[model samples]
Target: MSFAERYGPWAVIAGASEGTGREFARQIAAQGLNCILIARREGPLKELAEQIRAESGVECVTASVDLAKPDAAEQIAAVAGDREVGLYVNNAGADPNGKRFLDNDLQNWVDLAQRNVMTTLKTAYLFAGPMRARGRGGVLLVNSGACYGGSSFMATYSASKAFDLCFAEGLWAELRNHGVDVLSLVLGQTDTPAYRTLLAEKGLPLPTNWASPVEVAKVGLAQLPHGPVYNWGQTNDVAGYAPNSPDQRRARVLMIEQHSRSTFGDD
Candidate 1:
């Protein structure tokens, strides 16, 4: 069956204004799915909706709302409103508090938790039920390499991604038999506007090997059938356990700490 027949008619992409989320919307629309694009920026979302409609001739709806808001999931659901949303991509997240744990304000951390953790949980709860009831759907959770271990200056960010990783893994097991596919897309540095801006702001150079958002989206979509977890460009087992032995995990943590100090000037 074609992708649309199997998992679509409609797909919802959170964070769809740009980068990987935008790429996902484009690719999914190309697969013949109508798209509901949700993001904080109305301008970019509308532009992307227009582009997708023009390019793919697929119906597109743009929802402009901050996913950090407590009622974001309900707002997205309202926009989707009875559409057979066969695929939902939870891709909206960021580390707003870039300072060290103690240096960051408590409210910043709370906001991060609400956006990264609470939003994902609530959105999944709202969307997954219908997908399961229909018995044909997909959920893709965009996670990061920071999920592999603790990140020094990015402690909360990493922890939130870890939650996503674990959540998707559990859902994969629970949903596989229900005709629902769940995938945790574990990504390394991807070349995106936000990431470039972040590097520029910190005076850090972009890595030559950073994955493109388009490539990441393509790989992630293609690997949905192989999940539980899909580590971009990696063939090794990435399920369960930290991708390292205990000693290696310790070494990796130290390396991350040193990198954090060098990058952020944190102790």
Candidate 2:
């Protein structure tokens, strides 16, 4: 089966307003999948949906939702209706305010956790079930190099991303046999509107080296079937991106699976 045949008819993107998430929606639509675009900004989200419909000739559904809210996942599901969501791109988590842990408001951290961790789990559980039953689909979690280790600032963000990485990998292992591809698309310093806004707010210059949202989305789609993880650019050696070889990550997943099976008697 083709890409659309295996994972098509409809796809949902969690952060489809701009940057990488927007790119992912466009790419998915281009591949013959109708799109459900979700974002906090309604105007941009609707504009993107119209653009996708015009450019790709596919139906586009727009949902303005704050993923940090407790009912965010349910809101998305409502927008998706009963359409089979063959692809789910969880790209809603990004910490634009790069403040030290204590410097930021406690509520901000809570909301971030809700958005990145809780909503992710809920949506994945919602969509992955049907995908597993159907025997084909994909879950693409857009992560970051910050996930590799702790950082002075962005403590909550890093921690959340680490959780996402581990979650995606585990899901990949569990669903690969069921024909559901799960990929943690780990990126390093991508050139996105949010990143630029954050830097501008801090009065800092743009990084000389940054990944392109377009390329990142393309690589993510191409590498979905080869999952557990794909470290984009392999840059940011300091944050431990370079050391994340695909073979090593895959082996680690297998190793942990073996340990779990042995300990639990594989149910």
Candidate 3:
């Protein structure tokens, strides 16, 4: 059976151990899309794979590799080989502590770039080759909404996502007429395990009306066709870039950065 036929379509997601990445896997499972779940920790990924297979009744494969390591892309690509990949979700990333950009350790930036930028870029590029040749495929890059302007504390994370936004949209335009769909999700606050930890550490209240993983996943996946650039919200995350209000885009980012840094020492 063909890829789109066997699993009904297949999606490979990086950073599948937790948060949005895990949700993406479950969402793909709901679509009957066979999934290859990748992450640094094998335990969580394997557990997630089993849960997806059992709950959604779709096949799930797990790969544990630090996508930041050299040659990691090749290793991931080899396993992903010709599975007739129809969808690729580049969701792996790390948030450097809220620190002044220059004051932080240099290695943190390198590590973030390797995971947030290089890994995702290489995987997407490798996957797109088959997707393009097959004339059918979809790609979704999970990014922070901070890319609109970014934050002082979260500088590196925000800039890294900016790369994903550009890459996805550019590819979307190229593939639009060719049958491949490339999309980006500029995600807002979500209810994940990390939120509580961050909140407790910072001694701050949780953001009101934050989204859940399932909610974000449903909207993000549905909006893939509208083509690159979507904001996850109460419903579909298909909203394009925001209006040009002075602070609607940039002000909040700055405020959040200031607050986040003040609460926890920037890493």
Candidate 4:
């Protein structure tokens, strides 16, 4: 099936308060679908839901959740209840305390993993079974450009995203013939409150060169059911993705490491 046909007009987005998640909500609403918004901050989620309802006339449901505690995943998965979930956009994510690995709070690292990976996994595991039973479903996992070689200061965040990227692909392969379209979006730096907080924590002095959430959401929505992972549009991304062979991929990894050091190192 085509991309549009695969996704239809329904979506559920986590981290829906700001950034790519919010953009996804808007775009999907415009696509003429109802939406479910999940995030810890209910105020913004409610505001966005109201905006989408008023502007796009799409039904919006808000679930204020901190998907980091034990059993949080199961609780989140239970929301679907009797409804068949058509599109699951796992956009919820968190960064570690922004300290170095040695200085970072262990609990923060654990929270990052639970929120970013565990929650997405639970939702997919629970909802996909039903969607597959119905012979249709689309899963959108929001990964990051930081998941490349490795991350230094933001090690936990990067590792969690890597899990997201890999899991999306593996699951997609399993569900393809079953009409399940699983997608992993490898997003670059985006202009959002979360990104701002992270940059401030990292003390990056350089000017921002980032992509918009709208662009990320649009490209992601266009590419699912075809494969697992896709890098969003950005001119510089060409150089990063050009590497194909295993050796070349290694070279690419090294390059990412070098650039990351330069970009994040104290000047």
**CA lDDT of each candidate?**
0.84, 0.90, 0.74, 0.73
State every prediction's TM-score relative to the real structure.
0.88, 0.95, 0.82, 0.83
User: In terms of lDDT, which candidate is strongest?
Assistant: 2
Task: Give the number of the best model, judged by TM-score.
Answer: 2
- Per-residue lDDT over 74-150 for candidate 4, one digit per residue giving the tens place of the 0 to 100 score: 76666545554688888877563767777977888888888887777888887788778778878888887766656
Off by over 4 Å in 2: 235-243, 265-267
Candidate 3, residue 215: the lDDT equals 76
In candidate 2, what are the lDDT values of residues 66-178, reduced to their tens digit? 99999999998888889999999998888976889999889999999999999999999999999999999999999988888888997899899989988998899899999
- lDDT (tens digit, per residue) of candidate 3 on 1-267: 443542247788887888878998887887778899988899999999989988989888888888778677888888777676788887776573566789899888888888878888788888887777777888888877777777787788888888887677667756765677777777777777666677768778988888888777778777777655666652332234443322232334345555777887553
Residue 184, model 4: Cα distance from true site in angstroms? 1.0
Candidate 4 backbone clash number:
0
TM-score of 3: 0.82
Positional deviation of residue 72's Cα in model 2 after best superposition, in angstroms: 0.7
lDDT of 1 by residue, 94-208 (tens): 6745679889788788777788899999988888898888888999999887888887888888998889877886677667778888888888888888888888888899899
Q: Give the poorly placed runs of model 4, Cα more than 4 Å off.
A: 1-5, 201-206, 234-267
Deviating ranges (above 4 Å) for candidate 1: 236-267
Model 3: lDDT of residue 91: 75
**Pairs of residues at least 3 apart in sequence or in different chains that clash in candidate 3:** 98-266
